[model samples]
Target: MATPIPPPAVTVEEILAELDALDDPKMRAVNERHGNDIGVNLSQLRAIAKRLKTQLEFAQQLWATGDSQARLVAILISSPKKYTAEQLDTMLRETRVPKVHDWFINYILKKNPESESRRIPWMDDVDEFVASAGWALTSHAVAQRVENLKIAELLDAIEAEMKLAPDRLQWFMNECLASIGIHYPKYRARAIEIGERLEVLKDYPTPPNCTSPYAPIWIHEMVTRNEGASEVT
Candidate 1:
């Protein structure tokens, strides 16, 4: 009585084809029109490329984060290439039972001849597109969710460029911070404190009609200092 489930749509060959596009020099056309050739421009281009890679990788990463079936689907859908029917069935079954081997082999075998789905980076990889998108998305998403109209698209763009996984980025920053030869504990402690502060601030509801505490106060501290005020508002 129930409708036969539509086939799990993507095919393996399609995945393999999609994986081939990586590092395609043609992708450079996206930025070649910018016409800048300075060191700053080179750095900017490098950052742009890194974001594209991260967004692509994170599309796969999202799959790894969901429920097992969902995760497996994510992996198949976003991975650089497809798995063999045996491999895919194995992964699907493993989503529920890690060691089970029994499967619908004939159907799988028949389907395996052309299992690849069309590679759809523009469609499948939202993260890559997302990384390149301007800050309007952030202001819209943030304001809609939290209702802060103080949105600055330019500031959001800067923040997005600056964002990174702290632990990972800190691992790199640690080397430079270490070169100064300051006591490592103080360095680490300061890092940890900043991390803690950021988490608290981000998670705390941005209070209605309240500006960010970390934002610079409007009243000039120079005026307050002349008035001999401490902790000037």
Candidate 2:
């Protein structure tokens, strides 16, 4: 049998070089539309992430010294399972850009074992990004039907805090409410009631036929869809 040659190992320096080489003005414009002003596209970052594979340690090194796009690649390549809550907190603290903030929350924090543990504490944090992360995580957890998640507590938080929450956090809080309505039939009525009371994002412009973030509208659409699906089944 012919011998198979192994792929050469990728080093941090090689990865850095690749990132620097792939900078594109057109991609930068595209990224700008997504709140990433950094000059690298998703495809390039994905390619680097694919090449580096999962290297938590190396990913940390990359995260420590990169621009927005590089840090994004780092987030993609890192193993969230290996991150401690404290370490993740530090990363969250360091996030200055909206794109990185969203990526870290959705891609890393949401997948981590510590996510549930951190959600409440993060929601309590005064930092805008941390609070946003908490709400975003809660929304995802509720949608996935995470066991033991205190839906009552979430509802309480929304009732008491949603009006006063920072702009970004309020948005996710609305999402969490919609998730409750969509996934937990028992809580659906309450979720819609809360949404109607809060009236969040009611004036925010939305595309035609798109679900509005105004909690009542969002919950109603989701519930209607669930009913349609159930009837079909």
Candidate 3:
């Protein structure tokens, strides 16, 4: 067998240079519209990540002092599996914008082995970002069909506290509710009942041929689609 090639040494300065090379004014404008504000595009970030390979320590250093672009790269490069809850908490504390929040949840928090352990407690956190991360992680768990989800507990939470959940967390909590209703057959009826009672996202606009985000309607549509898919298969 051929000898394994060693990964190149990547310094924070070198990573910054790559980000500097990839900055685009137009792309920054577009990203700003979506709440990213970071000048580097996803493709550029991914290319840099590919080039540098994984360096969790370096990534952490970059994230601590870097601009939005550097932070984005840090998220891309960091190993979620290695992150302690305290470290993750610090990152979540630093997150202010929606784009970075989205990336952290999808790329780091959701993928971590400790994600479920971190979710419910984070939801109880008063900090908006931490709570939002919790809801987002829960939504992800539901979508990925993780076993033994607490459907009754989730339903109870929705009924007792969803209406009063933090502003940033409402959307993800709504998503978690819909996901439970859609994926867990036994709890479908109760979830749907709660959705109807809560009516979250009832008036949210939906594009043509798109399902509304209203939990009851969203759950019904997903279940229907799943049944149709099963029949065809």
Candidate 4:
């Protein structure tokens, strides 16, 4: 009689551990491409992927060795985004089902090397649905990280036009002045007025004929408005 094939190797925990061991940059690249908003550190991403992959690999191995647990792969790829870490951990920690976790893991991590299609373990429609859903979730998350090239180009063109147009530049400066409470009319007028005032003050001797204007009460604030404004601004 023919002998029975041994059970498949590789556990969800082991896969997770292996993935976690990847270098920071590699893990970061993957996260930047597919991770949700969680922004998990590189180590964390690796660990998660490793655990997920182990389960996936084991399922594939079981199918190759004549097992029917391949049905479980449908659970993961069908709605990867819906599963939480706690749920995954709980399943792994408590799993008594043989090769089910492996099937699920294989479905998550496996791919056609020559084609973009992921194995559906079911009908073509199910595979297509899972692929579309997984990528939609992944892309939406990654989309935030990638620059919007069209909008960036539009902004750049607007900036370039501003540089070529003096009116826009002047308008921009005027708005900036308005924001800062700088009155343009008063600013220029005051400049000319100060010049005239300074010429008159220049005639005064450095040492004043009179002493402190306020007898020790407030020597500084007693200065003339023209002098005070000049000193402060």
Candidate 5:
């Protein structure tokens, strides 16, 4: 096959136009219920980023627009390695929209070299959202088996804090707790005990065939799946 011509580069305005056109009122209402105001579908936003490719400057311009959809595209196109810790922190703080904040953490900070370095500090941060991000980073680290994570300490914190934490923070902390139980066989009992006693997310409704977010239930479900997969292997 002959080589295809790449699409010409589009400016931020063009990208913004594309994003605005993609906006859906129904989608916005749904996202609003989940703490995000942006109406653009994530898959479509990602498709736009695929066309833009990795454009650091373009990403900066999009992020500067303060439009959540634009910021999502900015995160998708930006070079994870190009950001400094301070810049990432500033970007994270500026990202008030829930989806934007999540994309920034997952697409940028998680892939950045400074990810681990930021995790503890962010977890200790006074800002609930920032601390939630920290717990998210820590959950990722725990799942990946990063060195010296002090699983016991994480469990202790979750045990002591999760039930009283703000909604977002509690969710992430519960995630970390579940991650530890899933990944560390030795701590599985303790993790489940803490989760059961705290009763965090116990009543959160789950759709049919979907696992519950209550840490013990989540831990058991994931662990069972892993065991079955291992047996298959």
Candidate 6:
């Protein structure tokens, strides 16, 4: 039989050094403004992750280092299915950087089997970040139209609390509203009305040619885009 080649050496220190080597001051400044203290070009970080391949143990070690850039790499390498729900929850709690927190929710938690189960409890969590994750999950669910989501109850909660929600939590809540307005035709009018009334993120700076994040405008823009694409086909 042919001999199998050994896996390449990998360590947290080496990965940290690699991340440091890729860091950019301009990127770091932009990230810091958005609550991420460390910034390595995400494309470069993704390349490092692709080279390492998926290793849950190595990913965990990187996560433990608590460097935002390292955690981004960790998120890229980690398997959502390998983690217990409790461990995922703990990781979410420990994620203090905005970029890292967003990536964990987007790349890991969204793929986890326990995601739907965690949604309500997390939505109610006292911690803003955790609650934001819950809302993020909820927004995903809304877009996917997952069963038994209590749509009326969601709109009710948004109508009642979204105006006063902390910034991070409020962003996700706004997302959920936009998702509902964009996806569910029956509730579309109500969603738009709610969004206009609250005006959450209405004045949020949008780059040239980018749709606004103001829920009402976002709902309209996305709905129009989807319709146009449908017509093209």
Where model 6 places Cα greater than 4 Å from the true spot, the runs are 1-7
Q: Write the per-residue lDDT of candidate 2 for residues 19-53, one digit (tens) a residue.
A: 77878988778778866767766777787777667
Q: After superposing candidate 3, which stretches have Cα over 4 Å from the reference?
A: 143-148, 208-211
| Candidate 3: pairs in clash | none
Q: After superposition, how far is residue 89 of candidate 4 from its true place, in Å?
A: 20
Q: Local distance difference test, per candidate?
A: 0.30, 0.84, 0.83, 0.32, 0.90, 0.91
Which pairs in model 6 have colliding backbones? none
State the local distance difference test value for candidate 1: 0.30
Per-residue CA lDDT of model 1 for 1-233, tens digit only, reads 99754333333344323333333344434433442111223333334323333232443443344332223223332333333544543333333221111111112222343222211111122232212211212222332343442323322322333235232222222222221112222233343334333332334355676533221221122223435754553
Clashes of 1: 7
Clashes of 5: 0
For candidate 5, the lDDT comes to 0.90
User: Tens digit of lDDT per residue, candidate 6, span 123-143?
Assistant: 999999999999999999999
**C-alpha TM-score for every candidate:** 0.18, 0.85, 0.86, 0.18, 0.94, 0.94
For candidate 4, write residues 143-193 as lDDT tens digits: 233233232332232233323334322232222222111222223333223
For the record, the alpha-carbon RMSD of candidate 5 to the native fold, in angstroms, is: 1.7
Higher-scoring candidate on lDDT, 2 or 4: 2
lDDT of 2 at 12: 66
Estimate the TM-score for candidate 6: 0.94
The best-first sequence of candidates by TM-score reads 5, 6, 3, 2, 4, 1
Which stretches in model 2 have alpha-carbon errors above 4 Å?
1-14, 26-35
